[model samples]
Target: MPPRDPSALVAEMSRAEKLSLVRGTADPAERATGYLPGIERLDVPPLRLVDGPLGVRAEGERATAFPATLATAAAFDPALAREQGAAMGREAVAHDQHVLLAPGVNVVRVPHCGRNFEYLSEDPVLSGTVGAALVDGIQSEDVIATVKHYVANNQETSRTQVSAAVDERALREVYLPPFRAAVAAGVGSVMTAYNRVNGTYMSDHADLVGGVLKDEWGFDGYVVSDWYGLATTVGAATAGLDLEMPGVPAPGAEDHEGEWPDGIPDAGHAGLFGDPLAAAIDDGRVPSERLDEMARRVLGQMARIGLLDGRERTGELDSQRHRDLAERVAGRGTVLLENDGVLPLADDADVALLGPHVHEAKLGGGGSSETTPFHSVAPDEGLRARADGTVTTARGVPPVPSRSLFDRLPYLDWGRDDEESDRPEPSLDDAVDAAADADVAVVLVRDATTEAEDRDSLALPGRQDELVRAVAAANDRTVVVLRTGGPVETPWRDDVAAVVEQWYPGQADGDALAAVCYGDRDPGGRLPVTFAPADTYPASDARQFPGVDGTAHYDEGVFVGYRHFDAAGLDPTYPFGHGHSYADFAYGGVTADGTDRVTVPVENTSDRPGREVVQAYVEPPTVEGVDRPDRVFAGASPVELAAGERREVTVSLDDLAVRRYDPDGGWTVDAGTYGIAVGRSARDDRASVAVDR
Candidate 1:
């Protein structure tokens, strides 16, 4: 049968019917109660939508649970991410849901932001590439994938009202890239954020929703406001916002009476039934033809996603295929920061595991991003399972007392209260004593929670730096595993024998960590953001973030992360893309043809099989008037090579790479020498050719 024409459907509807189409009905029970008063009854049933980005999160029986977005991101495999999305799609179908609200694409701006783990990475390319893969995967199952928190939702505290006071360049370069990528990848819907961008609420920002997203980016999807994110109906509707989420009562209702309040002033309420839409139709504020066009896009997406045809199954949830992919990704995303030959621990070596995070695994970060897992493996259990020799563990820190990094460190808790809890705290003397007897000491220090939204300082949370120093001093072969959701100040970098940064690996994190430690899996992941020393940025100096007036100014502009460090000639503790493997890899055969592409040869010199992410950094020629520094021109494919295997990876540059943003929002490629470097991480690389534009 042919699909219902959206224009015909809209033309046939009354004002109430039009209103009903925009408001979502909660469930079958709610649908039958005439809860959506504006919707006119038709032969066709109302579509059902579910809450999510992680998985189908409706409170019901037999709903398949998947890993959180952070956990999935830690896997760092696009195929694995796609499989996760497909699984969510299948579950959404089972639950009779038309839209799956997910794949939150917010950038991880600060280490302490509450919901940092829910996003992919700090790098726009990494986040966008991964998000696009996931979006494609979900939509492949014929389910609508709604990309969320539209722009600049970097923090959770006061998120509904806080203004992300970023400049136009930073906003375009950092905050908006991922959403643009998702839109380009064919996402069905876009969810407006609760927060404001600059001085305007996301739902009411005509420049963002109307000017940029729709007109500039050529996004054809309907924009829906975050649940209650809309403060004014008139402003939102005029800004090209198509839907109000979670279904709010019509204009001027009193105390759940489901009727307009008596003597309610027009207050723009006269335009409630899209009278503005009708007036806009008459006066050309909005063309009547455009309304049909918008409606058509919505219905077209609905039909494309199988919502109109009824729910369809694409794949089974939590199948062996998905589990295998999950395990592979979990292993791949682990980054081995440092190794001092103590790792690949000899089967006969005695291993003493110390730290609060050892037995009590800190898998995922807190917030709506949390997931109910089928199971989670712990480090001690994984270590014990693999060890042929003895493995002893001592409770070094308590999980509850202080969740910050300082609280878990031995000397940092000297004068704190609440000393009488069941949670054990290892003293400096005790930790030293334990290390004296052990051949190797593994200290699992966790710095997961940071000051959400607003961080007072960039200092390491607790006595973790002290604990790491003390433990490393006591034992020659000490391995420090720093588990955190974002970057931390690692001042004692030179002291520790080995340091591994495990960014909030999800439920199966323990197993993933163990896999990297035991050399069962090589750490292929790299730092997506730069790790600077404590008190680096201007925000750190002010001792306030998101500011008092609910606005955060990005004074750093384009110089974010490594870009800042490189341009300013400052050294970070760990530069972006800094990760080490047990095996050695070499980069050579660097060749670039000035205009389109660069190719590099990657050789695996070690005896073990591994993958190397060949990052290509570009330094565009200086323009007389352009004030911006160098940008990442191109990056090569992630080369997965076996022992003694060599492969050539080619990187292609686009017009955006060489383009410099003008003051008036235009991009121009300056004619100059561009440096092309290839390496495992940003800090460790070999450069060869320079492209002259």
Candidate 2:
């Protein structure tokens, strides 16, 4: 039989069995990260969820670690994003995980957020475009794709308690678009954020989860709470949160100090979903029909992912093909922020690789996104293989110790044993000595930010600024390779000869870095988020950032990221979509096909084949009863062309791009001429065209 209707299956299930299906399993073996016990009587198999907005988070399973989602967004290619998801999905299947909690669609509201590396971009259009593609790719491979941290889960500090007091218009335009895109892409699950929204916890929000998502948007997928994110049982079920994760870790004695003891939480407790939920159901507080709906959604997804049919596959896990995909993402995502004609290191040039990260791959940021790759390519190893010149190495600074809980876990430390853990921190004199004689000095710097915490400042952490300045002083040709999760202010930016933002490149970090540094590949990425001074960011207000009295007021409204800086008539250190290319390109003409379609001619003026991201931004005019950002990222398209190649890049704007949302009314388009700029980055507008609606 071709699997009975999920509705009929739920109808056949007893109330207790249905209740079990809605919550995480209590069995030790089944509950790693995601789990649900199946009734043997009903022939339902346990569903397994795995962590991966980067890659599989299985402790011992050596899966492929691709670049962070931010990196994929930097590529500005939804097709590449799809490939990234497909690769991760294949790896998830190999690990026997039905649901891959991935493609975190949370908008990068503030640069200080520790988890921004895992997110896509500040622009809702860009984030949604890439996120939707990722969802489609993962689901194509019979894996359940979860678009997570639903609505305004921006900052990590006080994340569990802070209420994001956002207006309805900002929520619709800025934060919620990515999740809407994910739902439109047919994602199987949506994970509620830890924080509350407008004084209501997302897990218990009736208007959002029940009214908007379930009814208004017609999202049929189940809603799962973040680990330990379930606040109340009756409220959650009635509000449409289908699953409570890890079941409120054993109450009496704190079994372990960290979140995941032994790389997996002991899920043997049923604190919230057991007696509390059963009593609520028995007393008729939560309707039985609602329980049946939850069971149906879960079973429906299980059927969709082929979990009920015992889905199995082989030969796709950790394959060479997957590695190539990872390298491509890393290479393309590497943004050349600044250059002074010193890059594309000559084969004969002598190089001094100075920094702690040069010999180690800062594969991904700390937290749930961290993964132990099957094999990680160190920067030194990659440089040695690619460079024909003499390559000397030095640890310029002490390794930034792990403040992240995931980095301290024993399982992640398994493959890190071979690294120089106890090596003495090299003095500044030692680093200067190494760089003094080299033709070029490449310094790899990083930031130690993780989930549940935010960076203290945008400045490079510790004595890294001093280290970079000293090295740059010693050698005029100093190149700084930043492996950070998000934007960091560069105090020594002028001192360095060149700067590259690699955004925590994955397992093939070494190979990817080498390819971009040595001219084997061009830095094809543009900034998805703005690199601004710490004080200039709109969220710089003390009350806005870490929040005041456990509430983050979105007082700046829709002016976020580049939009904020633009509205303030201020310039950023590096504007959103800003990146330098080795090859030059000239813009020719701009034309509008329709209200939504735009075409711009771009011709590569350089001899080398290069990739270009043509960005389309709209300057919406002020209208009655509406608010608009100075400029909004309407649409963007990535194109690869050979030397002297000419092409017309066309970008089509969706309804969300040109429309403004109102509380009393739905999305409305203004009846005026909108100025469209075709450019390389948000700051580099080459051509402009106006179209009257």
The C-alpha TM-scores of every prediction are: 0.85, 0.95
lDDT of 1 at 192: 95
Q: Global CA lDDT of candidate 1, please?
A: 0.66
lDDT of 1 by residue, 1-693 (tens): 455555566677665466555554445443111122223254344555566664565543333334346545544456767877877777667655667777888877765565665677766766787788789888888878889889988766667677878888878776788899899999988999887888898988999998999999998777876654665655677787877665544333333342212111111222232444555556766655555655556666766765554544554555565555555566676667778778767777788787755675454554334444555667788788877777887754444333332232222233545522545555666766677678888887765452233344455555666667777788889988877666767777677678887766555666667777788887777777677875554234332355566776667676655666677777777877777777778877788877577888889999988877777766677667656755562454566789999988886654445666665857666676877776665666675677787
Question: What lDDT tens digits, residue by residue, belong to model 2 across residues 28-111?
Answer: 554247678788998898888888889888645778888888999999999989988988888887877778899898999899
Candidate 2 residue runs with Cα over 4 Å from true position: 26-31, 248-270, 310-315, 407-419
Best-fitting candidate, scored by lDDT: 2
Cα RMSD for candidates in order? 6.8, 2.8
Give the alpha-carbon lDDT of every model: 0.66, 0.85
Ten-residue segment with the worst summed lDDT in candidate 1? 260-269
